[model samples]
Target: MRFAWKVFLSGILVTVIALSLTAYWLTQAAFGTALSQEKQKALDRMRMLSVVVESMAAEYSFSSEEAELAGVMRSAATGDFSSAALFSKDRRALYGRAGESAPMEELFEGAAAGLCHVILARDGGYDMHMLMPVQLGVATGYLYLAADVSAPFALSDEMTRTASLITCAAAVAAGAALVVVARLLTAPVRALSAVARAFSKGDYAGRAEVRCADEIGELTRDFNAMADSLEGHMRELAQQARRREDFVASFAHELKTPLTSIIGYADTLRSRALDEEERFRSANYIFTEGRRLERLSLKLLELMVLDRRDFPLRDILTGDVRERLTDALEAVLRGKYGVTLACALPEAAVRSEADLLQTMLVNLIDNAAKASKEGQTVTLTGRCCPAGYRMDVADEGAGIPEKELSRVREAFYMVDKSRSRARDGAGLGLALCDAIAGVIGTELHIESEQGRGTTVWFLLPYGEGEADAQ
Candidate 1:
């Protein structure tokens, strides 16, 4: 059954049993005690009457004189005794309430039971009964007496009624008390059960409201903690899913760009109409595009491996930050754009992941070089932070807008989509840098004010103890 109903029924059943036993015991006890008191009173009266009769017999018997026996009967009529009678030893009634016969027949049939009480009548209605036998000796006549048992009978009946009333009231009180106790005890458990159901249905935010310092409250606290952990895990899973989708889409596009160029030039070379010069030009185009395709594939593979855990860290190398910055800037500035590469960096060797570090620098510097006016400096700055190191690649020309800075590192999130396409980017460059920075426990920060300039940089934590906030 439901919990509340079970508690209520149990309370009721217990109360009923308790009251029933109490009523039965009290009823029996009151009746028994009343009967005993009455019987004792009757016996006392019989004893007194017997004493008077014996004394009279001793003084007047066999003297040829008639004795007044009425005084003896009258003398036995005290408040404690009812009808007192004189009986011969042979079971003859001498006197009593005018034809009151004592049941000496019972004494002959069984033991006297020693002044026992029976149900009897004062005036023939059988209100209650008590009788006692008295004998001067084994040969003398006996005196018989019964108490006026009406009062005890009435009182016993009243006591039975009172006990019954009390039992009923007690039953009702016990039932109410038990019900209240059960509800108070089980409230926290019920609330916890409800919250468990809610949590089973996937509401990780569900909580039991049990607040006391007991088992139920401890269970509630544990449930809330589990939910908090589950929610955090779910959020992490969602974020990973988004990152995966972005990675796949961007990687596919990057691969397709070089593939399309290589295939187009190769097909041109295959056409039979092309002469030596034309074929040479086509083959050169194919060759260049093939190299670009090779680079794109290698970069994609490196990034994919880095994204997964269990990829071994390639050794930590100590290197001068300034030297690395110079090499990366020189490599990007080789184009006829005449973009000047400027480096401002610390001379000291810093711990770095060489391949990842070089690539990160190349991508930022290349992008800066692409956006710069010829003869303008694409300034590269390397500095040390409390955490390991920092590098900035900033360009003055055609600066990225402030609003798009945050999303710039996002895969394929080009602010100038058409211009980015002409620059022959696989669009995975910044995304690669961002991922590498994350793998090495660093952050890539970007800042731009519209029409001013854009600066892309990385912050490398100094040690494992360095604080990182995402």
Candidate 2:
């Protein structure tokens, strides 16, 4: 059903079939070969006996050496045969030994005239014999020699059993090897299929493991490339949507502050009995909101411009880190929140951009100030790190939630919607901070918990300032 299943099954099926066919054919061939060799050897044994017996007959007829001939025949039997015989040209047994004596004519009875290896009885030994008539046309009695074939047959039987065992073992080993090859072949496919399923379920971060440099690896490379393209496109769309929403919210917040003050001023001026002090206060409120709106607009425009630029860092300088941090904090922390701002800056200079470093630190401190209670403390500390300088701004008020900390730095992203609007703030501080940090090559570090207050800071490469130069 699934692609991985198909791959696994296909591999296993091919291996099993191949092993089975090979074992069957090899076993058949081995059996045939062994049988042929055994049969040939049996025939050769019969032939060898023909030569031995013919010589014995010659000795008996030429030298009257019947005793020696019988002794030689008995020795050749190896105790596995009971009888061997030589008959004269008159169809009379010349030398007969079959456990007892018989008339020469009576014993020379059989009509077999060629070499033959015969299994004597159901429970006895085999006999390899050669019978040759001495004369051609008038063929009379011949020489007969016999030897047992039981040991050779037994040996052949043992070899056949051993061969069967070896074949079985080879088949088993082949099957195991096939299984291993099948699993190896199917592994990459299985990994890719799993990743594909994960991607289907909306996890674009899914990845497939590369197992080999074969076709499967090529396939995985293509699939991962496709996934990367899709993920980038999706992220682009999400970013565009968020930007649109942020623009609308920032505009509305900025407009509302000034419009509220303008409306108040208009109400006061319209009243017939308004005093001079009340008139001036109402007019001042209108101007104040307008100035706030102006500041919000300028900040937003600057952020937009910075966002389009590819700000790669160069022309770095070493400066007094403490002075830069204090200047930024003092400028930004002028609001009415009653919080102690603590700074622990090192009297050390490092390579960085001064203005960008100051801006980033100011924004982080400002964010912490907003999150702090009236009597809480916001502490700013600068320390030297392995790669660069570390700045920390920790607060003692309401902290951000564990999940929503990542989105807080987004333009117009307010964790507390109602409170943020009531404060007449445009929610651009963190966004501006993030942009400035990027321009100067630093990372914004934000940590938060529900009621434990929020901490936001930026670590920058420290650099030269006017104080350090002096």
Candidate 3:
């Protein structure tokens, strides 16, 4: 059966058994007490009658054979007796009701008391039979009395029927009440079960309502917590799936662009009769595209490797960061882009993989220089914090729009696709920097406003060697 019904039926069974037993005991006790009291009252009346009979005998001499004896006995008998008789010592009935006889032989043969009381069954009813031996000086005989007890017994039977009916009604009410209570108790559990089923079927929005301060309430709370966690994990998984799909499509497109350029130019160099300048230009174009492909391949390999495991770290100072940024800027943009460098380096040291850190810095500075107008200053700043060294690379160029900032670190995503392609950008600079930063225990934070500028920053844990040196 269902849980509520099971509990209801069990409660009902216990109530029925308990109340029935109690009712039976109480009714029996009441009936027995009343019957005993009635019997005692009957005996008391019989004793009083014996005393009257003795007085009558003392006043007048009487014989069992005399008719006057019956008169005396009838005069002494009270109206409570259903039948009255005087039995001689020899067991002969001298006086009684018209047709009734006292069963003296069966009742008094081995009896010990001068007053004998017994219950006799007749015509499906009961009679209280009392026999009292009477003594009148030298004469002795038995006075017999019978009182109907069927009414009292009938009353007891009626009480039992009434008690049974009342108990049944009470049991039903208690059972129904218990069923409602059981339903109320299990309601939260039922709601939780439904929520779990819905969540399992991919409907994560369902939640359990916790309305009590009991174990069930605690369970409801725990269920909601687990559902929240599962929903979050599902969302993360979906985002990761979409990221992988976008990465594949972007990678294919990025690869196709350069390969197509190299192939087209190589075909021209091979199939066309060209002058020295035309042939040389086509070959150089192929070489330049080939070199761009090489850079993309190398960055892709680095990102894949960074994702797979932890990298070793070493002590490096913020001064070292400044020097590296200067050398890389001079090598890539010193005389080419007219990009000016500005530095604010502190005497702070950090723990990091030096090569990965340099590559991350190089990518950030290169992107910054590429974004800047000629004669615009690209600022590189580093300082010590309580936990580590923090660094910023900011460019005075067209800033990324706020909406596109979140995806700028995703592979092959660029804010200005055409500008990036024109500048020979493969759109992997920030993605590579982000991957490297993660490996080195940092996050790349990008902040920008359109028509203003963009700044990228991160922090590195303080090195143990630096701590000891300080």
Look at candidate 1 and give me any clashing residue pairs.
Answer: 120-128, 120-129, 388-461, 388-462
- RMSD, each candidate, Å? 8.7, 13.7, 9.0
Ranking by TM-score: 1, 3, 2
Let me know the TM-score candidate 3 reaches against the reference structure. 0.56
Number of clashing residue pairs in every model?
Answer: 4, 9, 0
TM-score of each: 0.58, 0.38, 0.56
What digit string (tens of lDDT, one per residue) describes model 2 on residues 181-201? 667787898789899999999
Cα lDDT tens digits, model 3, 249-361, are 43553464346456666778889999999988778766755665566555544445223436667888778778655644553464556788788888777888776677677
All candidates' lDDT scores? 0.63, 0.60, 0.75
Which candidate's lDDT is highest? 3
**Considering every candidate listed, which one attains the maximal TM-score?**
1
Tell me which of candidates 1 and 2 scores higher on TM-score: 1
